[model samples]
Target: MSLVNRRRRPPAINIVPLVDVLTVLLFFFLVTMQFKQVSVLNITVPKIETAGKNEIKEQILIAVSAEGEFFYNDRPVDKEQLEGLVQLAGDTTPDMPVLLIADEDAPLKHVTLVMDLCRSHRLNKLRLQSR
Candidate 1:
């Protein structure tokens, strides 16, 4: 065969693996990261026999202390105020998720009162927090 000059193409950098790794990292961070709601009250959340991971995003944090005091988003509120706040939130965002943080020693009636108010205001997206 006659000797001929052959042109060689430059090596291409593959980006598929890098894209895959970035996608996996993004998913890992998104799945593990959650919104942490800080409460001013020292209410002990009740414990459950199940997992502690929550899939629902809490927009309104309603805390009930062992003494049956209500707190709305870390701010102390009375029963009437709580109802008004819930009503306003429900009117603004009907599907807003509400997280109830009640002390383990809190009475069942107190917890149910908050639940009843939420339901009355059409804010049924409620989830109970646990220790």
Candidate 2:
């Protein structure tokens, strides 16, 4: 009998398919992710025993900081600028709701001032947000 020697080849791993799958997963996550716009200021809203959710299609958001500073749509503004923004919003939408998101430590006077502004502008649909 003749002596015969055979060399066995190692199996090859294809990385192209793995890379394609990872890329697809990455894109899927990016496409389905929901990003929320967060404010820079630290705000802790007060909790209430009785609070209901009111969803309005079109509304303006006003944030009042603990220091009584005003922010319209996340941008800082003075009283005059706030008034102008409110007026513009009212002109665009007659009965658009105004949502007031005030910090828990904010003074009552600040809240009252915002309410007064809304009342003066005839923005009757006003809602206060709390935790």
Candidate 3:
């Protein structure tokens, strides 16, 4: 046999398939992802002695901070817009109770304003948030 050596082919690395698979997975996850907003109402509910036991659902939660900032379902609302906001939420869940969750240090007037909104909307099943 001749002493001359033949050139060997370089090893091949195929990344096309890997890249395609990764792209497909990315698209799948993007399309299947669910978008939902879960608003949290941080509050210290007032304690009560004569409160009754009841099942509450679809309640419109209102929150007030210590600074007297008003929030309905975690969204800030101007005093002028209070009525419309409460009415809209109550209308959506007509039978649901209106729950007011106010901070312990919140002004009594702020808490009272929320109660007033609920009362004006004719919401009977009002509940206060508590620790």
Candidate 4:
């Protein structure tokens, strides 16, 4: 009998498992992804007796305290810079509403001044503070 040498063959490649795992990962990411962007501010507004729930689109909250202090979304701002700040905020979202939240004891002149500024800027949506 003649002696013969036996050679081992290499293993076959399998791509199906790899493709399945990749597809699963893709689906997981898509399902868990969020598409919305949210912006927020922290400020205390006065409560009003006649306050009603109103639908607010995009808003730049202007806060005024009883001490005649002015704030842009909880951040203190210089009274002289009110116009500039309002312009900047309006620029962020051109058509967004302006919400003015003044404390019950806040000076009326402050609120009126803010409203006048908004009107001058042609920002039509204006909401006033109450209660």
Best by TM-score: 2
Error of 4 at 107 (Å): 0.9
Candidate with better lDDT, 2 vs 3: 2
What's the residue-level lDDT of 122 in candidate 2? 82
On residues 48-95, what C-alpha lDDT tens digit does candidate 4 reach at each position?
688887667557778877788888776788777888987776666567
Of the candidates shown, which would achieve the greatest lDDT relative to the real structure? 1
Q: Give per-model TM-scores.
A: 0.69, 0.74, 0.57, 0.58
lDDT of 4 at 8: 59
Give me the displacement of residue 1 in model 4, in angstroms: 66
Candidate 4 off by > 4 Å: 1-50
- Alpha carbon lDDT of each predicted model: 0.89, 0.86, 0.76, 0.76
Clashes of each: 0, 0, 2, 2
Candidate 3 displacement at residue 29 in angstroms? 22
Per-residue error for 57 in candidate 3, Å, reads 3.3
What lDDT is obtained when candidate 4 is compared to the true structure?
0.76
Query: Stretches of candidate 2 above 4 Å error?
Result: 1-13, 19-37
lDDT of 2 by residue, 1-131 (tens): 43466666799999999999999999999999997556686778899879987567567889899999999988899989998998888777758889899999999998999999887878888899877
